[model samples]
Target: MSVEETMNYVLKIPWHDIERNLISRVQLKKIIKLRIILDKREINYPIYFYVGEKRDHVMIPYVFCSCKNFTIRVMSKKKKPSCKHLIMLRLALDKSMYREIYIDDLTLLKKIINEIIRIGLSPTLRKLLYISRNRRYERGRTDGA
Candidate 1:
């Protein structure tokens, strides 16, 4: 998407479910199946998914990815910024978000995913966890408390 198009999506007409990527100017549909597998031991699993009318697709190895946008825009040496997938990859490596995954370690990713499955993931549970941890702030428990 071009800068002008992105701006229109963000300003002129807003998408209800659109979320601002903390690290980029793009508004991406919620990323699903936060999966990461590298090295020979990685298991067959679902990774990043596109949220659109079509069915979800799997994330191929970066080099092998169709990468139409990047190939068209970057390979020919355009002046635009990188694509969303590349931006996502850079975010994953930044150590700022997605603290659950170990960007450099496959073993850690496996362990985290297994734990999430075992404990279960739910919006209510997540909200409850947040509230419980920030009880002091949420309920105004200040120094006087």
Candidate 2:
């Protein structure tokens, strides 16, 4: 298999399921660092990261790195999967030395929304959400609501 596939497979294994004796913390850190370096060298995009606090545990959501390609398409009003950024983020997380953070598809959106809420931008986001929902509703309706 290709190196990317192999690394992805290794990272796909949940941290809880992995044997503690098989992988050392130091090794995990090394993996994360290497992935970050590779991502920096290859992908030229902005990455969004989120951290949350709990009583004793910290909540680190999945990473979302938006591709310049995807952003450009979005600006041009097109829909497409800019997989390069996602791949880079995955590669980084898979190889990360830290065990706390998990990268999922919703990670980026959730982080951004949470930040908006935190900064009291809820009203604006709510309006946008409402407009989006209404647009979908109108599209589905036989008569305009």
For each candidate in turn, the TM-score is: 0.28, 0.24
Model 2 lDDT on a 0 to 1 scale: 0.36
State the lDDT of candidate 2 residue by residue for 38-74, as single tens digits.
Answer: 3335432333232112111111222222334434542
> lDDT at 41 for candidate 1?
50
Record all residue pairs in model 2 with backbone atoms less than 3 Å apart, i.e. clashing.
28-97, 29-97, 31-95, 32-95, 32-96, 32-97
Q: Write model 1 residue lDDT over 11-109, tens digit each, in one string.
A: 332233333553442233223334344563545443443222322222321221124565476445654344455444334333233222113365544
In angstroms, what RMSD does candidate 2 have relative to the true structure?
A: 17.7
- Residue pairs clashing in model 1 are none
Top TM-score hit: 1
